[model samples]
Target: AQSPLALRQNILSTLGRTMLEEGVWTFPFTRWIKLIASELSAYRDAAPPDEQQSLRYLTPQDIHEEIKHSGLLRYGDTRTRVEFAHHTYQEFYAALALKNQVDDIEPYVDTPEARRRWQGVIVLLYGITTDRVKLYSQILGYSNDYARIWLAAQCLANAGEDIPTALSRLQEALVPSQQFALLFSVGLACRQLGRYPEALTYLLKAAEENPASAEVQFELGALYRQVDQFERAIFHLEEAIRLRSDFVDVYNQLGLTYYDQEKYEEALTVFRATTQLEPHNPYHYYNVGTVQKILRDYEGARESFRMALKLKPDYIEAKTQLDMLEKALSTGVVQMLEKIPMLSKMTLEQSVLLANRIQVKEYQPGQIVFHMGEMGDTFYIIEVGEVEVLAPEMGRSSGGVINRLGPGNFFGEIALLRAVPRTATIRATKPTRLLAISRDDFSAVLSRYPAIAHRLAETSSLRLLRDRQIGRRVDLDRYYDPGYIAELTRQDRVTVLMGDIHGSTYLTNAIGPELMVAFLDEYLLRMSSIIVQAGGAMDKSLGDSVMGVFGSNPDVPGDESLPVKAALLAALRMREEYVILRDKWKQQSPEFAHSGMGIGISTGKVRTGTVGAEATMVGPAVNMASKLSKLAIKGRTESEVYIDGVTRQLAGDSFATEPLDPAYTKKKVGVELEAYRLIRQK
Candidate 1:
C-alpha cells in the first residue's frame, strides 16, 4: 500500500544498487536476465499438475527483439544489471521459454553433472523434478520403462520417498549382470532403515551382479558387521579394500569389526596398518593405540598415542592414554620396527633409528604419487594397498598400467641413489600407504649396510630392465574407423606420431633383398603393435615411415589430452620395439646392423574426415610430426624422439628436455619450427 511517489523512489534506489553491483566487472546483463527467465519458465510450466500456465516464448536469440519492442524490461547503461523496469514485467512475458521436452530421460539422468547443469536449480529447490515423476509415472503405464526406470529409481533415492514402489519398478527394468546401480542404492537404503536381512539380500544380489563395485562391497561388509557376521564382513571388506585402496572409512570399519570379535591382535594389526595408510588421521593412530594397549604391546601403544597427539595436540583421549603408556615405557617395550621387511635385515639399533624417521605417506585411488621426469629425493616402500607403474612411451603415457606393486615392495630408489629424474609415473590404484625415506637418510644408512646397499642396486637394475621391456603387442582392429564415410567434416583436434626407419636403405643394400624383406616385415609388425596398443589409430605405412592418428573423433565428449598422450606413448613404444628388432636382425644377419628408428609427435587442430573410400586426417599436426620425425632421423647413432611446443605444453610438467636448434620444414616457406628432443620419459 505504498503511494506512487514512494514506489518511484524505491525503484530508483534498486536501479542504483544494481548498477553499482554489476559495474565492477561487466557481463551482458540483458542477455543473462533473458536466459535466466527462459530457463525459469521451462521449470515452472513443466510442473506435473498440468497445463494452466502460459508463457510468451522467446528463443535466446529473440531476447534482443523482445526487449526492443517491449516496454516492461528496460536496457540500462551497458554496465547496469538487467532488470524488469516494471514490477509485473516477468509475470507477463514468462510464457516465452518452453524447450521441446525430451521423450527419453535416460540420457539426461544417466550423467549426474549434465543433469545438474540442466535441472540443478529446480532440483535444489524441489529435490525432485515433479514433472519427471509425472513423466516417469506415465511411462510406467506403458509396457516397460527399460533403462529409463533405473534413472527414475536414482532420482527416487534422492527424493527419499516412494522408494519401495521405485525399487519394484527398478527390479523389473534391470537386465542380467553387473550393471544394476539401483540395487546398490536400494540395498544401502534398506540398511539405513535398519532392515538388516533385507539389506543383506539386496547387497548380496548386487555383489553377485556387479562384483567390481567397491561401494557395494563396502556396504555389504558394513551390513555384515552390523549383524555380527565377522567372517562374511571381513571377506567383503577386504574385497572392498582391494578394489579401492584409499576408501579410508572401510579400513576403520574393518578394524572395528576385528575389535568387536575380540580378535585383539588382528585388530591391532589392522589399526596399525590404517595409521600408516592415513597418518594424519588422529583417530587412526588412536585406534591403533587402543588395540595395542588391549594386546599389552605397551611400547607400540605409547608410540601410537604419541603420534596421535603429534597430529592433534588437543586430543584428550590420546593424551590420557599416552600418560598411562609413558609409565609402562619405563620398563622398555618392543617396537614394531623389526617387522618392516626392508629394515628386518638391518641391525636392531639401525632399524630403530631409521624407523623413527620413517614417515607414512598415503594416496587415494588413481592419485599420482610422482609423475615421470620429476626430481627424486625420496624412496618409497609400500606399507599397505597397491600402486600401478605407468611408463610414458613416445612423448606421452599410453594410459595403461605397466606393472603393479603391493606391500613390502619399493620404488624410486634408482632415481634417488643415481641422482637422476623419476623414470616413470607411479599412481595409486587403491588406497595405499607408503613409507618414504629421504635420499640423504637412505644413503647414510646404506653406507653402514653394505649388503642391503648391494641388494638395492640389484633390485633397481632389474626393475629398470623390466621397465624397458614392458611394452607388449597391440592389436590394431580396435581403433581404426575403416567404415568412415561422408562430406560432413568437422574441425578435429589431433595428435600425430610419425616414425621413419633410420637406416632402411643401408640395411637393404647390405643384406640384399631376401634378408632385408624379412627385417622390414618384422619391423612393421612390431611398430604397428606398439602404435595400436598405445591407443593410436593406424593411419598408414609409407614405404619406410609410419603415421598414426589420435583424437579422430574430437567432437565426442572425452579427455582433450588423450590424443596427444596416446600419440606420444605409441611413438616411444615403437622406438623401443625397433631397437629390439634391430638387435635381433644384427645377430641373425651381421651385414645389416645399421637399423634404427626416429619418432616425432605433435598436436593441433584441422578439418578431417573420409574422402570417398579413402580416410584422411591431413593438417598441420600431421605435417609437423612428419617433418619432426625426419629431423629425428638425422641422428645417425641413436634412435631419437622430438616433440613440438604444443605437445610439450600439454604433456604437463616433468620432462627431461634439451632444446633443439630452430629448424625449417620444407613445406613452410619462411617460418622456422621450434622443437625439443624428448630424450626419454624421465
Candidate 2:
C-alpha cells in the first residue's frame, strides 16, 4: 500500500489538473490548503500527549509560523499572506473559544507564569511584540509555509482589508467550527468600511451558526431599529437579554423598547431594574429619573436625580432636575394662595408665604368648587382620587369623558398659561384631592426656575407636534429634498440587486399564460408600490426582475453612493411585500403560484448615468446588479439576496452579511461570478 503522503500527492496532482482545466484557480489553492491540513493532522496523530509541545501547533500563530517556514507568502505581498494567516487562525481560535477551551489559550495579558506556558498563543491573541515581530520577519526572509501564508492573508482580511482575493487563492481552506465567528468579524469590518448589505450577509452567517448568540441578536436588533422596525427591535433585544442576562447595556435598551410602545408603566419598571443593576451607571439613573418625572412622582424624580449626581458629580441632567423641582414647589405654593378670593387683598410677600403653606383640597363627587365658564385663578390636580373632564354639551346627552385623570395626575395647568375659559366641564369621578397653581404664581415660579421653564416649553412643543395629526406616509418628492438622498447615501450606502422569476413557461403551460400574467402583474404592482413608499426608486424592470436603487436623489444631487442604497431599501420593501402577496396568492391560486423575486445587492462604486434615446434614460449599474439577482433566480444560492463586500461595509451595526463562494448564474450577462450574500434575522 502507498503511504499517506503518496496518496495525498496523487490526489493533489489530479485535483490540480482538473482545476486548471476548469480555469478555477480556487480549486488548486483549495487542494494545496487541504494537503497542508493533512500534514498537520498527521503530526498531531503521531505525537504523544506530553511530548506534543515539542511539535505542538495549537494556536493560529503556531500554524502561521509553520506556514512561514513553508513559503506561502512568496506568491503574494507579506500583507496579504499575513491577512490570510490571521483569518485561518481566527476561524480556529473562535471555534475553540466557543467550545470553552480557554485552558489551551496562553495568557495574552502581561503576567508572569502565563508567559512561560503559552507564549506563541498569547502573543498572537494580543498582537505583535518586538521579539515576535523579529521572529516572523526572520521566517519571512526564507520561503514560508504556503498553508500558513494563505492563513495569514485571511487574517489580514479580518484585520480590515479585502480577503476575497486571498480566499479565492486558498479555496480549499478548512471550514472550522468557528466559521461563523470568522465570517462575523469579517462582516463587522466590512460594515466599518461602509459595506452595509455585505456586513448583513456575513453577520447573518454568524447568526446562523450560533443562533443563540447575544451579539448576533443585538446586531439584528440594531438593523431593525434603523429601519424604524420598533417591534422587531423589541423581539431581538428581548432575545439577546434572554440569552445573555449579563449583557449590561441591554437592560436599558429593553426599557427603551417598552417606552416606545407607550407602555409607560412597563417601561418604568424596566428602567428601575436597570438602575438597580448598574447603580453607578449615570445614564441608567438619568433614564429612571426621566420616567419618574413622566409618571408625576416629583419627589421620587428628585431623589433619582440626586442619586445620579451622587454617582457622577458632573451630571448635567441631575443638576437640571434640581432646578425644575424647586420651581414646581414654589409655583404650587403661590398658586394656592392666589386661589382664595378672600386673600385677594393680601400683599404679594404675605401671599407668597401663605401659598406655600396651603394643603391640597379633597373634593367629593358632585361637589362644585367652581363651574365651567366661571372665573377661576387656579388649576386642579387629582391628589388622591379620580376626576373626569366631560364635554357635556357636545352632541351626547351626558357627554364623553376625554380622559380618566387619577391620583398624581394634574390638569387645568394650561388655564394658567392662557386666560381662556375651561374647554370642558370638570367633575370628580370619585372622591378627589386637588392642588391649585394660579397664573401669577406660576409666572413667579418660572422666574426662579429657568430649567423648569425650559422643560415646560419642551413639553408644550412635544404636545403640539403630537396633536398636529400629520398623516403617516409623507410625500418624499415634495417635502423631502432630492439632494437629501445623496447625503444619506454618502453616510450609509446600501445596495439592492433584483431578479425576476424565469423558467415559468412550464408553469404557465400548465396553468395558462393569462393566469401567469395576472399573477405576475398583481405581484409586480404590489411590490413596486411597497418599495416606492419605503423611499426606494426602481432602477429598471427586466421582465421578471425589478432592479431598484436606494439613497438616490431624484432632484439630481449627483451623489454616486445614493443610488446603491436606494436599490437596497427598495429590495427590502419588495421582500416584505412579497411575503404578504405570496401568502395571499398561494391561498387563491396554487397551480399558478410563484416565489418572490431573487435579489442581489453589492455596495461599491458603480457608474450611474442616463443612457438610451432622448425619450429614455437608463443606468448601467442596473446591468451590474443582475449578477446576484440572476444567481438567485436560477436557484444557484440558498440566499435570496446576495450582497457584496462593499455593501457590508456601509451597513455596519445596522445589518450583517455573509461572505460566500463565487455564485454562478446564466443570464443576459452570462457565466459564473463572485458574490456576497446578505443575511439578517427575518
Best by lDDT: 1
Estimate, for each residue in 47-99, the C-alpha lDDT of model 1 and write its tens digit. 44433232234343354345445554555465454555653333122111111
Q: What is the lDDT of every predicted structure here?
A: 0.60, 0.51
Off by over 4 Å in 1: 1-127, 131-162, 171-179, 242-248, 314-316, 323-682
Candidate 2 structure quality by residue, lDDT tens digits, 166-229: 3333223423543454555555555555566776676677678778778777766666555567
For model 2, give the RMSD to the true fold: 35.0
Give lDDT for model 2. 0.51
lDDT at 141, model 2: 23
